[model samples]
Target: MSDADAAVGAEVDVDLDFGDDGLVPAVAQDAETGEVLMLAYATREALSRSLETGRAHYYSRSRDELWEKGATSGHTQELREVRVDCDGDALLYLVDQSGGACHTGYRSCFYRRADGSVVGDQVFDPDDVY
Candidate 1:
């Protein structure tokens, strides 16, 4: 067993490389429910924090800052497992979610249809969060 693998409790870090944007894709899923909740971006710091703290953290491209999930919304994700893709360009965060993972009151951010259909009925209101 290698030192890095033991430190991360994983097989290996496929490739710890990011793009010029300094961002890598992060996939968040419900640890117990086995449902995909959200997809965000994580910088090196965010990934380190998530691994160290066992909480989901992300980098907001729009805000250009670190985002600790549920910091203000009270919907934090407790990290259960963190995996880097073979290419190391993406991550998977399995977590125990508290409150609604979706800003729309759903359990996940992937509440919309993939067919490009219009959604009129909202499960939750954004006003409640923002």
Candidate 2:
């Protein structure tokens, strides 16, 4: 294998502590701005798919299936790198996000505060897309 391939293999081979449900929480962040985009769950297969495809893939708890981000909305996230937390129970995905990251049309899922006030602008209209 090429040196780059070997390095990726070494990184992916690490034992991640997926919980009983075989899922790990993955935090997606904007690679350029360092802004957190969204939080989602991922299966081993999802992680592998993300690395292999260079796109963000996540397991949907509600749908009970795997999905590629922006598969329908066209707000795809281009995966740049993945980092495992020290406990190996969580993942950080650095990506180049296109358009809005939140399905609610916001750039991030954290657009609101504890007071239910909006702090971020809506990048798109959910009605138009979804």
Candidate 3:
């Protein structure tokens, strides 16, 4: 392993409190702008992979597998740092994001308010990308 990988591996050794399903909620935020990008679940393996690879990895509940963000859409996230919540049950991933973070072409998953207002910019068309 490279020095960077070793350092990440050491960092991933922290004990996290995974839920009964062996998963924890992970929130991804733009490191520079502090924009909340997306929220996903993570397995221990997924967390390790994110740290080891310096990229975002998430456990897809619908797909029932682990996935690297932007593996297909090309909107990848470069992980800057990870912060654990006080309860150790959640994680915050500070990342440098490229392209829209939302699959629907929005910059963030929380593009709409409870009233359903179209507020966030549509960076790309999903019909063309997906």
Candidate 4:
């Protein structure tokens, strides 16, 4: 790590601003390509685990539990860097993606443009994996 990065990391003492529901939005991005892969919610425990293990972890509201990215599809995201927004209410996870990030087999969750134009090439076949 660069001296600057090391210094920033050493200051991992910010109070995470969780919402009233005890959740925060965590956005995951591709470290190299700078593509935003996905956005998921994280609880305090999930955030701690991600910081601890250097992997992308999230709390699924649907499942009501912690889940590591790619645990089932083998498309794990290794943590590269983590950043909190100025307000400390949001998180950014820069990760090295092993496979596609989206369950729909796209490289990013932002597959469709707001204008309804489908974007991004499919990186994998979801059927083959999940």
Q: What do the candidate models score in CA lDDT, each in turn?
A: 0.78, 0.88, 0.87, 0.85
Clashing pairs for model 4 are none
Q: TM-score of model 3 relative to the true fold?
A: 0.91
Please report how far candidate 4 places residue 43 from its true position, in Å. Answer: 0.9
* Model 1 per-residue lDDT tens digits across residues 10-120: 333467777999899999988777888889999998988877766789999998999999998888988777888878899898888887787777777777688966443
Model 3: lDDT of residue 27: 100
lDDT of 1 at 94: 83
Error of 4 at 23 (Å): 0.6
**Candidate 3 ranges beyond 4 A from true positions:** 1-10
Q: Candidates' TM-scores?
A: 0.80, 0.91, 0.91, 0.89
Q: Which ten residues in a row have the lowest lDDT in candidate 2?
A: 2-11
- Compute the lDDT for candidate 4: 0.85
Please tell me which model should have the higher TM-score, number 2 or number 4.
2
What is the C-alpha lDDT profile of model 3 across 1-130, one tens digit per residue? 5322332543754669998998999999998889999999999989989988888899999999999999999999888888889888999988888899999999999999999997787899988889
**What TM-score does candidate 4 reach?**
0.89
Q: Which residue pairs overlap in candidate 2's backbone?
A: none
How many collisions per candidate? 0, 0, 0, 0
lDDT, model 4, position 45? 80
